[model samples]
Target: MAGKAPYIVPVGPIHPALKEPVHIELTVVGEEVISADFTPGQTHRGIEWMGLSRNPVQIVHLTDRICGICGVTHSLAFARAVEQIADITVPERGDYVRTIIAEFERIQSHLLWAGVAAHELGFDTLFYLAWRVREEAMDAIEVITGNRVNYDIIQIGGTRRDITEDQYDKIRKCLNTYKDLFSKLKKLFLEDAVIKSRCVGTGLLSFETAMAYSAVGPTSRASGVTADLRVDYPYCAYGDLDIKPIMPTIYGSDVNGDTYDRIVVRIFEVAQSVEIIETCLDNMPPGPVIWEEKVAKILSTCKKASGEAVGRHEAPRGEAVHYVAMDGAEAPISWKVKASSYSNLHVWPIILKGAQLADIPVIVASVDPCLSCTDRVAVTDNGSTKIFTKEQLAKMSYEKSRRMMQ
Candidate 1:
């Protein structure tokens, strides 16, 4: 063993089967991997920097494209940043709408992530089942926001559309349906022996290591790291909900920070999201959904105004931090984004060590990596990505109105 050499296996930014572009270098000694490295490949698009130079009006749209799954979160974060800089206090109704929309986005994102994790583990049936339930959240969002992905509903001072009494009822019913579905899904993920066998004791991320890497979301929660922006740093309607961050506890066995724990944490969090949304809907106050006067005043002014502010949102993947610096002159001078995935990526090596080759994708997907493309879910890089044009979002809005008529 004195002069033995290790093999460097290079994976890709465009692997044959992977849906996203990632470059992974695995240093292996025969069948066992000694170390591993991962990069975004050609994924970074610099949308954040572009926000800094564009007018504040356009930055909201640009921010929407930061991540397909977390589009609403990005928009909200940017809006919050701009609102803070302009010293604007959004109306109470605007706060409620923002909170409702954010929680809806969280529900869909977590469900999509659960399905993706299952698909990576070769559980195609489970993937389909999870997505089936997710459609409920998606349809609710489409009904409320006029689009499934990039809602384009959030504006600087308030939301664009107001939630009517009938629309509120529709949302509550949808939440009820999803609550029952998620309960069953949680049982399957936790009690199923087959899932437990593959997931348990795989990818052990210790609590200390998680803190060191500054892991975010369920990935860090699985390791018992108590970090949640919703609780620690409340925003919008979160302060009213009294939501607590759910953490895992040691069971009968050793606290193995494996795939099982990650799955459990996400499943539990999904329920928490559902609860939060319902609370927002029930306690929703009656007022103008937006600060119409304030918005009209800002839009009418052609003069440029700017300031510096930082906005953070609890994205499905983790805590997404957006740093906005405006010169108080033109649109904006610069914008910077630090997504949770950016930080969680550092924890990969620590968890991946000693994990089996077959478990690689499952473990990676469990972290809910947001390898953002130019478009949303429909528009794949292989000409398969489907994105709704402006016209389509408008049409969807009309359809929702028609549904209410029925």
Candidate 2:
């Protein structure tokens, strides 16, 4: 900790977590943050509120725009909810197809996070390498869905597109490319001295803390909390696959959910996603992708659908859950979206306690937060919030690094 500076300093009203604007108020004692509180909801799109006004068919498209990284998963979750309400049964092929696309999204998202994590610690080389490899996944996804980010593949009862043999081959090639780099990625991310120093003991979140805060996905997995919706809730084709959550303990980490552990867990998850995608492709049964009869009369069916259901998808970040209630009308009577970022926000204060100003970005990014999906606003009239410029933040990190070197 350095000498006590300002009494109350705001670390962010903007961050590199694009479309994920957040404001964090940090109370500092010198350079070490003594306490912190954050403001979310800066990216509020009111998708949930708007969803209630639309029919299930229309809401499907709305959910897809919730977050680009996990857009498919959000729509999948919405579809699951609607399907449950309508007592709709997706074909085996549909289930497998959904799983494949979700896993591919996971692989791509984890690579994105890996690159961002490397960049946070001033390792631009690794950052470039990770993203350079991510291009392959994007290519494969485009080949399958005709779009890179928002595939819009998962419809209510089934997927709108089928995985042709040629696309499957391309996917395999992409996975193979990732597999070939596994050893190199494994070494670079896990064993690199600089990565270890910056991340190993930083942003520590214990398993107990994770559970207490209801953390999910890699955030909790990094802390050895085996909590994953794909396993726990067993939705879609995850029940058929032998799903295993990745924990950082495998790398001799103390299960002390630090930024480093988060990195390891996300990287391991990319490998796991590849395996799951391969399994899904191999075992997919031959059938039409979407329920043609249902789509032909979708509006009529949803207008008559009356029930409540919960949908859960293991998004790239964590669990993207939606609760839906239909009142036998063209629109849902009520709908609520709880993205992973909502659950993840609670754990931040715990992890950020006693953390240095230089570590703020690392700790915040560790959770893979998606404020766009889950955020709330706290408004105050004529609020006086202190701001730090990039130059100031960078100088703080550089000074800390210099001191560490000294």
Candidate maximizing TM-score: 2
lDDT of 1 by residue, 147-172 (tens): 99889988878898878777977888
- Per residue, candidate 2 scores C-alpha lDDT tens digits across 1-406 of 3554658977567756332578888888888888889877677665776676688888888888888888897899899998888877888888888888888899988998888877877789998999999999999888888899878888878898889887777889998999999999999999999888888788989888888899988998888898888888787789998977788876776677788889989888988998998898888899877765466486677788898999988888888889999989888889988898799888889899888888888788888888777864334558864455536645866898899999
RMSD of each: 9.3, 9.7
- Tell me each candidate's TM-score: 0.86, 0.90
Task: Please give the distance, in angstroms, between residue 107's alpha carbon in candidate 1 and its true position after superposition.
Answer: 1.0
For model 1, the stretches where C-alpha displacement exceeds 4 angstroms are 1-5, 250-255, 293-296, 299-304, 373-406
In model 1, residue pairs whose N, Cα or C atoms come closer than 3 Å (at least 3 residues apart or on different chains), thus clashing, are: 52-334, 306-328, 378-385, 378-386, 379-385, 379-386, 380-384, 380-385
Question: How good is model 2 by TM-score?
Answer: 0.90
Model 2: weakest 10-residue lDDT segment is 11-20
Q: CA shift at 194, candidate 1, in angstroms? A: 1.8
Error of 1 at 165 (Å): 1.1
